[model samples]
Structures are given as C-alpha cells and as structure tokens.
Target: MTTLYLLGSAAPPVLDIASVIERAQARGYDVCLGLTPSAARWLEPGAAGLERLTGHPVRSGYKAPGARDVWPPADVVLFAPATFNSVNSWALGLTSSFVVGFAAEAIGKGIPLVAMPCVNSAYARHRAFGRSVAELREMGVTVLYGPGGFEPNLPGERRPGGFPWELALDAVDALAP
Candidate 1:
C-alpha cells in the first residue's frame, strides 16, 4: 500500500480538501491526514469520519501525547490548500507542530513533497513568499500554483483554485517502480 500524507491548512475551503482526498483515494492510494490547528475548526463534521473514509488516523498537533507517535514516514506528502503562513514556516525549516514535524522529516528522508498553494493574490504575490517557494523548489519540493481566472473569497467561500489532484497523484505514481 502506498502511504500518502495529506497536509491541510487552517480554514481551507471544504470543497478543496474533500475533492482532493476523494480523487486520491479513487486512484487506489492509502491516505492519512495531518491538520493545522485552524484546519481542525473546519473539520468538525468529525475527524473520525475522515479517518473512516481513508482508513487511517487523522492527526493534528505534536504535544497531544499519544498523537505524536501516529505519524509514519510516507511515500508521498501533499499539502492541499497550503496557507501562506504554513508555506513560509515550512520554508524556514520550522517544525513546531506535528504537521510541520512530519513534513520536515519526510523531506529529510527524500520523500516526494507537493503543495497546492491556496492564498489570495496579495499573499501569493509577496516577494518573500515567492522566494520561499523558490527555496522549497530548490530542495525538490513541487509547488503548484492555483489555476488562474477565479478569485477566492477572503471572509468565506474560499474557492478551490487549481485542481491539483492530478499533479499530486502523479507524484505518487512516479514513486511506484
């Protein structure tokens, strides 16, 4: 079974995550989730439900005692709806939380890492953000920009920008020898 780690940002649009996971599973991959603190607020339909759907535990935070051990090295790591904050943090090599920790460890092991950046135009256009993304790319991380033409809402209705599911799955497929 191919192990896939799904990393999500805080308050990601519901449609974005649901569609990404559904598409990945459809391609016959085992999926696990690591959510940011803010992401947990939007996942209240129940993390257990997500786990049931993927048949693996959905985890968040590092200091959750037993939860820290749930993270396993994965074949592929994908961050769907990646926030500007998390992107910067990851770029700076910060592993303050379980999500970040797992990402850092995965990258260290040369695991394939992909991210679907979901941010407004201002954040996406920031010089620092661009530099950080470039740095991650230099480290072999694949960062997919959101598809153009659709404006995302600020307060709510965070539109699912690009359909990054295909790109994510392709990364996994490359690992299958």
Candidate 2:
C-alpha cells in the first residue's frame, strides 16, 4: 500500500481534505493527515471528519508518551495548500509542529516530497518564496504550482483539470519504481 502523508497549511484554498482523501482512496492509496496549528483553524470541525473519511487518525502536534507511534514511514509526502509560513519553516528545517516535523523527518529519510504551494500571488511571487522553492527543488522535492493567476475558494473551483490530484498520484507513482 502507498502510505500518503497529507500535510495541510493555513492558506485560503485549504485544498478540501475530503476531496483529496476521496481521490487518494479512488487511486488505492492509504492516507494519513498532519496539520499545522494554523491549518487546523482553517480545517474547522476538527480533523475528525477526515479521519472518518480516510479511516486513519489525523495527527497534529508531537507524539505523546506511548502514543503507539501510528505513523508508518510514508511512501510519499504531499503538502497541499502549502502556506508561505510552512514553506519558510520547512526550508529552514524548523520542526515546531507535527506537520513540519513529519516533513523534516521525511526529507532526512530520503522520502519523496511534493509540495503544492497555495499562497496568494504576492507571497507566491516574493523573492524569498522563490528561493525556498529553489532550495526545496535542489533537495529533490517536487514543488507543484497551481494555476498561475486565479484564486479559487471552493474545492471544485481550485481543482480544475485535476492537476492537484494528478501531481500527488504522479509523485507516488514515480516513487513506486
């Protein structure tokens, strides 16, 4: 089974975890979600809905004492709706939260990482963001960019042509070899 680590951020699109979970399930992959604190705020109703949808717990924060260590080494890590904050943090090796920690660990273990940045045009075009994207690419992470212009709020609005799902599954498929 392909173990997918879904990392979320506080960006506006949010990537609609439910849609991502559905697509991943349809593609025959098991998924676990990890959320940043700010991302949690945007996720709303808690990640319980996601857990129910994917049949796996949504992990946030550090693992507790004897918490059973549920995270298996992931086959592929996809950070959808990756925020500017998360991009910056991950680039700097900051593991202050569960999402960032998992990303850091995955990178160290040579796991394939794909990030779909979801910042606004201003942030996306910023020099620092460009540098961070370059650094991540140099480290062999696949950085996926959404449509260059429009900012869509809803899942359907944002998912035109299914590039997000394609990028995610493509990353997993590439790692399969």
Candidate 3:
C-alpha cells in the first residue's frame, strides 16, 4: 500500500480532516494523520474516532526518548489547510512542531510533498506569503495555491467547507509514479 502522511494545521478546514482520510483510504492509501499542536487540540473531540479510522494514533508530538517509531516513513505527504504560520515556518526551516519538522526534512529526503494553504485574502497579500510559496516550490515541494488550487478566502468568513482538498489529492496523484 502507498503510505501517505496527511498533515493538518489549525484552520477551519481542520474539522473536515476525516474526509481527507476517508478519501485517501478509498484511493488505496495507507494514511496516517498528523496535526499541528493547535490542530490536535481542536481535534480532541474526535481524536479517538480518527485513530479508529486510521488504525493509528493521531500523532502531534515526537515519541519518547529512544522509543520505537510506530508510524512508517511516509511515501508522500499532503499538508491540508496549511496555516499562514505553518507555511512560513516550513519555508524558513522551523521544526517547532512535528508537522513542520516533517515538511522540512521531507525536502531533503526527496519525499514528494503537497501543501494547501488556507488563509484569508488579507493574509495572502503579505509579501512573505508569496515568497514562502515560491521558496517551497523551488524546493520541489508542490505548494498548491493560486488559480486552480486554494484561493484566499474573504476576511471574517467562516467558510469551513470551501477548502479544495481534491486539489491536494490530485497533486499527490500527479506526483506519483
């Protein structure tokens, strides 16, 4: 089976991560879910359900010292509803969380990566945002954004279901050999 790590950030779309997991499974992906620290807290209500769905713990932090790694190394990684903070942090090589850490290392490991950033139009206009997207793309990470990917949402909008998750999955399919 193709092992995929689905990394989620703290955003409105995080609530719908189960669908991503379900979709990947339908596509024959052995999916493991990883959440940013804040995302994990938001997902607390359904944490057990998520674990049951994937048959693995929804990991947010590193394992105990010298402890065995439970999850397998990812064949590909998809970061959905990636926050503005996580995008910039990943570009700047910040491993403050397990999700970002995996992103940083994945680049060097040559593991295929796809990212979908969820930000409002105001935040998307920031100079660093474009630069970070460019930087990630230059690293060969498919940072899904712009016209066909994730478009910036209007400010103050609670548009939870608007995230284009299929684009992320399509990126994965396109990248796969």
Candidate 4:
C-alpha cells in the first residue's frame, strides 16, 4: 500500500482529522499521522483513538537519534491545516518542529509533498506568507492556497465550511506511486 505521511498543524480542521484519515484510507493509502506540538496537544484526548485508526504512533517530537523509525517510509506527504508558523518555518528552512523539520528534509529526499494552509485573512496578508507559499512551490511542493485551495477568512472569523482535505488528498494521489 502507498504510505501517506499525513501531517497537520494547529488549526481547527485538525480537530476532526480522524475523518480525514479515514478518507485517505478509503482512497487506498496507509496513512501515518504527524502533528505540530500544539496540534498534538489539541488532539491529546483523542490520541489513542487516532493511533488506533492509523495503526502507527502519532509523532509530534523527534525520536531519539539512531532510533529505528516506527512508521514506514513515505510514498507521499500531505500537510493540511498548515498554520502560518509552519508555512513560514518550512519555507525559511527552520526545522524546530518535527513536522516542519521532516518536511524540509523531504524536499531534499525527492519526496512528493503537498501543503494547504489554514490561516486567517490577517495572517495571509502578511508579506511573509505569500513569499513562503512561493518558496514552497519553488521547492516542488504542491501548495493549496488562494483560489483553488484554502482561502483565508477574517481574523476571529470561523469559516462555515470544513477544510479542504480532499484537495490535499487529490494532490497526494497524483503524486503517490
């Protein structure tokens, strides 16, 4: 089965990521879930259920150096609900967080990567965000943003619709072997 490294960041969509996982599984992927630290915290109460769902450890932090990897090597990586911090950090090559760190390295390893940001309009307006999105694209990452992907809402405004996990998954499907 194709292994999808489905990564998430601290965003509301992440709250309901289990359904997304199920969707990916239905599409014939062996999904492995990774989260930003805050995202891991937000989903802590349901961590066990998520682990059971994926049949892999939900990793937010790095394993010990030289530790055997628990999850299988990725055939594709899809990062949805990527927060502003994660987007900027990844584009800037800052790998403080394991999710961003792994994504950064994935680029060099020739992994097919897709990302979708879930940020408010305020954050999207930042100069850094646009630049970061461009940078990721330059790195060969299929970033779902703007018209065809995630549209930012006003600050403090919750969009009525769910995050577009399907779009990310579709992009992954295109890239996955």
**In model 2, where do residues sit more than 4 Å from their true spots?**
146-163
Off by over 4 Å in 1: 63-68, 146-163, 175-177
> For this target, which candidate reaches the highest TM-score against the unseen true structure?
4
C-alpha root-mean-square deviation, each candidate: 3.4, 3.8, 1.3, 0.7
Instruction: Give the range where candidate 2 is weakest over 10 consecutive residues by summed lDDT.
Output: 149-158
Ranking by TM-score: 4, 3, 2, 1
Q: Against the hidden true structure, what lDDT does model 2 obtain?
A: 0.74
Residue ranges of candidate 4 with Cα displaced over 4 Å: none
Name the best candidate (by lDDT).
4
> Weakest 10 consecutive residues, lDDT, candidate 3?
158-167
* Comparing 1 and 3 on lDDT, the stronger one: 3
Q: Write the per-residue lDDT of candidate 3 for residues 14-113, one digit (tens) a residue.
A: 8999988999899889889999999999999999999999998999997888998888879999998899999999999989999999889989999999
Candidate number that wins on lDDT, 2 or 3 = 3
Clash-forming residue pairs, model 2 = none
Report how far residue 91 has shifted in candidate 4, in Å: 0.4
lDDT of 1 by residue, 36-133 (tens): 87787688677777877777677776645654455455878887667788888888888776677777777788988887666777776778888877
